[model samples]
Target: MASQEKIKLVLLACGSFNPITNMHLRMFELARDHLEDTGRYKVVKGIISPVGDGYKKKGLVEACHRLEMARLATESSEWITVDDWESQQPEWVETAKVVRHHHAEVLSSENNSNGDDVDTGKYRKRRKMEKKSPSCMNPKADRPHLNLLCGADVLESFGVPNLWKPEDIEEIVGRYGVTCITRCGSDAEKFINQSDVLYKHRKNISVVREWVTNEISATHVRRALRRGQSVRYLLPDSVVRYIQDHSLYSAESEQKNAGVILAPLQRYSKTE
Candidate 1:
């Protein structure tokens, strides 16, 4: 009997990450655990890549700020790391390009003898062709398998017009694979089946249903902050402190009122 070869799996989570939340980090862990349980993959790394300012999403903070906040959120986690490549891009590169770049980086670092880097050139050529040919089923074994990680909400939006190109969807779901963490009331299978391309490559899509929901979203957190409410446990302590020190999200008047409210509590606590 021969021992099965260990498959190195890396996850690239690209998004606004305007302010990294617990839910964002949780998806990585959920995906890693689910993949590892299959006994076919060894999850090595998870990279959180914030979208560049080129995305122009409303309420999106500066790329530098988002990058630092992500760093702070994941600094203590050993396997999870933050990548600024996407954040630093002068123009908004498509998600497929971001995934490919990271995959290339992984292959280059491994120094695999099987010409993993050469395959990237082939990928570029494939992108240029018009015909919808299925990508290579068997990629270089030595190269780590890189996949995109996102919430089910994102998965459902793939079919929306003007959001994702057909070629990009094929490449992302077909070539790179995706792990979608299911949100409450989201039917990933239904959405996948609705799209001809997504359905064809549905095998590459892994949907992990989350039973215990943590409905913590960046929007909700921002709203709470704006309303001068406590968001202590919703995010990591370091992230919370960063938000406080940097005065992010909260309106100027709200922050001033919050300070006034906290001063008395601070003084009373100090006396005790």
Candidate 2:
């Protein structure tokens, strides 16, 4: 009798990660723990893909900065890696496409390892087989299963009107699946029950309830920085230093004209 092959799992976390916080990193651990608790998957890699500048959200900062911050944040973690592919894109690419692109890259690399070109149609068929199989079993056992890791806030937003396309939602949930870490007051079950699409694909969504919640957000961090308050424990020390050194999120950052006004003062002032 042959032994069962262990299934490989990789998590892709897509977000702004303007200044990657401890909570952002925690989501990966929470999801990995939840999935490993099932005794069905062995999580190999965790990828943090920051959103492109094309998102155009206020206070988003630049993609280069965000990517560097993410890299710095996760440098100590062996399992986690930062992928700049999405950030390097010329324009904003949808989340679904990002997932597909990562999956394709993984598949292409795996195929190259075997010295063969990947066939898109055949890969899709293989994915379908893998998805249908039991947790501990896979027909094509070698391929790694890529899942989207996010917070419950992101999960709830999926149901928001005009936020995401119907097809993209279907592809994300139906194909890659999601592992959402529950935030305080965000009912993952209730959100699923309320939405027909979510309810239908509930099997693919794993809701990991967090007992002790960390309410630290980038917005809050930025606000604290702008007010000249201590964000010491909110962000990593290295990131904190980076922000201070770069003068990011400060009141001066918001005031474009401040440089001109302060140029003369800076020349005369000892604190300059």
Instruction: Kindly list the per-residue Cα lDDT of model 2 for residues 1-272, writing each as its tens digit.
Output: 12255567889999889679999988889888888877767788899999987766666777888888888888899999999999998877788899988876766676778776466677667656655753223334667778889888899988655556778888888777888898887988899999888888898888998877898899889888899899888888888888888888866444433324222133224432
The sequence of per-residue lDDT tens digits that candidate 1 reaches over residues 54-106 is 76565667788888889999988999999999889886778888988987777
Task: Show model 2 residue runs off by greater than 4 Å.
Answer: 1-4, 114-140, 252-272
The TM-score leader among the candidates is 2
Give Cα-based local distance difference scores for all models: 0.79, 0.79
TM-score of each: 0.82, 0.84
Pairs in clash, predicted candidate 2 = none
lDDT score for residue 158 of model 2: 82
Q: List candidate 1 segments past 4 Å from native.
A: 1-4, 112-136, 251-272
Clashing pairs in 1: none
